[model samples]
Target: MESEPTAELIRAQLRRLRLAANLTQEDFGKQVHFSGSQISAIELGQRPFDRLFLKRADEVLNSDGLLLGLLRIAELHRQPHFLRPWLDAERVAQQLRCYHPTLVPGLLQTEHYARAVIRSDDLLADDEVERRVAVRMDRQAILTRPDNPPILIAVIEEATLRRVDESFRGIMTQQISHLLDCVQRGGVLILVIPAEVSVHVGHAGPFTLACGADGDWVGHLENHLGGATIDRAEELATLHARWDGIRSVALPKGQSELLMKEVMESWSTI
Candidate 1:
């Protein structure tokens, strides 16, 4: 059987601790880890901490009861661990910023294009590929949600568009067409980083930012090992600065759309 709900187990335990000790959520997070927002996330069943976080929690909160008693119940639901924070932020963000270097970002990929991209990784078993693809498709619904459907800003490298003539040309065309629709609908902002523009701060890899309704922002950096979610103010500011630099180096939206439309038309030759 699945363990009792992870959120409930954690919230109950944390509430009792705070109440019995007469601590505010702000005080509790300061005692336990980082900030009031973090404690609020824990108490509201919106977040969970890692194992080593226990050691820090113990040291910070002065509670020997256990660092993360909820992990046993929550670990079963974990996948890639790296993506958990992305889901949490994505579901709440008012706007999203993504910079892609090679392939399209997952949020905007069509099923066929996504499948082809995944299949390129020979290490992924058939089942694992399906699971990953399903996870991505599940995220796509956020684009059309009635409330807080995020405004997406995507800055993609021009070289990536060259793959439009690859095996899954139709899918690439559809993805480009989808972008056109999104732009016309005012739901997305697309920019193309031309190969000629040689200078960029994010040249090493891809990153994203999820701006929350409360005005809080978080940054995500993806790597072969997994990904990184940054909530620290200074770090987030640095990421924002870098993204601004990238945008300045990219083509204006109208020009980029025209470029994409022209190339998509060229796909007929493939």
Candidate 2:
């Protein structure tokens, strides 16, 4: 198994490299187009660094992809512990089937929408929220990875598309537009369970099922507290049955896209 590096490890390396280069934090920050205080915060572990920061830092320090490599590994550590196993499965799965009843699936969410979702937890600190959002965005890379990208099939409740948080101005419009673009891009299929269907098995909660190239399967279930990975045969069977039931009521791809466009227009008016 691959090991994950801690934030402290990354911070220490940054400081060591910057010092070895004989540059003050301010000087290094100038080269990276960031303020000295920002560099100080990162080195002191007072703030979390995003991928862009790590990339620029690596280039400036001539680490030859060292920091960038750490960034990828660090993403795993940033995710909630309960979700890591499923995340590993998601990275290697040949196909991913996801169902969400109240919100857009994380794999397909835009950055703005993701930020809102993370921030919805008022108890979380700003840095923690940003870190989680970064992980969510990075997970999306698998969808378009040059290598055999997984075929993603997502089913979302129609209310997810119609609901808009007025506080976030154009968030819904941007999110719906992104979904349409994903549909146009191929290798992805998104269907919607229309609101008219008052009852469904999906109401039990959101779950994801992944199929591996080797004919194995992994399941994931999420609730308010946390999430769990499912590999047990009986549990997998139940999830599979629920998935079929939910997919049965969802609109076909063509109808789904049309409904999404209609919602997008409605959001634009708001």
Candidate 3:
């Protein structure tokens, strides 16, 4: 006798099977006639775990009836918990506005890129590294839900795009390619702040604004140590204003994707 399936449980099993099969979300999505974003939404529990999705996931993973069976469970166990408030806000956010000056936001990171970032500190054990990476990847689902995905408008620094890491040859290629695909897919808007811009309010730090369905909004900040959520309307309003300033300095989507393509092509030569 299995417990009823909750969103979390279904997402976990889906992620596990996908990882075990060594398939990227894009590749997995192709097999099921779904976009990578849609697959991501299902895996992150941002989208509903409908039977149609279960049927496709079952076919794609070669899981037979395992996924559907898991969906029938009553209660599932929890995954490692961190950033409870922020994660909660993201889960129901109707709109997302962000400015990242240092690195690509977690929601847009490729698995390889994410793995590199996760292991950079060199403090976590192997298991811990895997867990953190998985959690971060799961958070990206907010951008891919089949219905009512939060409108994501992110402005990243030009330097952040050019910053090369150890995985330049393989991971960078994948990361840029994934970014390109996301941009072309149209669920999110990504802007790049050119290096030529001398000064901007974004110089302070990275921040994200998540607006919930009920019109409530929150500001989010995350760093190497940890992350927190801000619910004060005044504070969130200020963050929103800052984000507007950053976006004003950022390149338009067409130019940004063109820059991304140049970088993606450069990775091949490296």
How accurate locally, in lDDT, is each candidate? 0.77, 0.88, 0.77
lDDT of 3 by residue, 1-270 (tens): 122356667788888999999999999989888889988987776666555577788888999878765653321134314556777788799988887788788888998889888888778897667656766766787688888888888788777767775556677778778878887888788888888997999989888888888888888886666766788878888888887888888989899988888877876776
| Clashing pairs for predicted structure model 2, backbone only | none
* lDDT value for model 3: 0.77
User: How would you encode candidate 2's per-residue C-alpha lDDT over 1-270 as one tens digit per residue?
Assistant: 112356677788889999999999999999999899989988887777777888898898999978777776866765678888898899998999999999899999999999999999999998778777877888999999999999999999888887766866498899989999998999889999888999999999999999998989999998888889999999999999999999999999999999999888987886
Note the clash tally of each candidate. Answer: 2, 0, 5
Instruction: For residue 3, give model 2's deviation from the true position in Å.
Output: 13
lDDT of 2 at 59: 90
Stretches of model 1 off by over 4 angstroms after superposition: 1-78, 164-166
Model 3: colliding residue pairs = 3-73, 3-74, 4-73, 4-74, 5-73
TM-score of each: 0.69, 0.86, 0.70
**Which parts of model 2 are misplaced by more than 4 Å?**
1-27, 34-52, 59-65, 78-80
Relative to the true structure, candidate 1 has a C-alpha RMSD (angstroms) of 14.1
Q: Please report the TM-score between candidate 2 and the true structure.
A: 0.86
> What does candidate 3 score on TM?
0.70
Candidate 1 overall lDDT versus native: 0.77
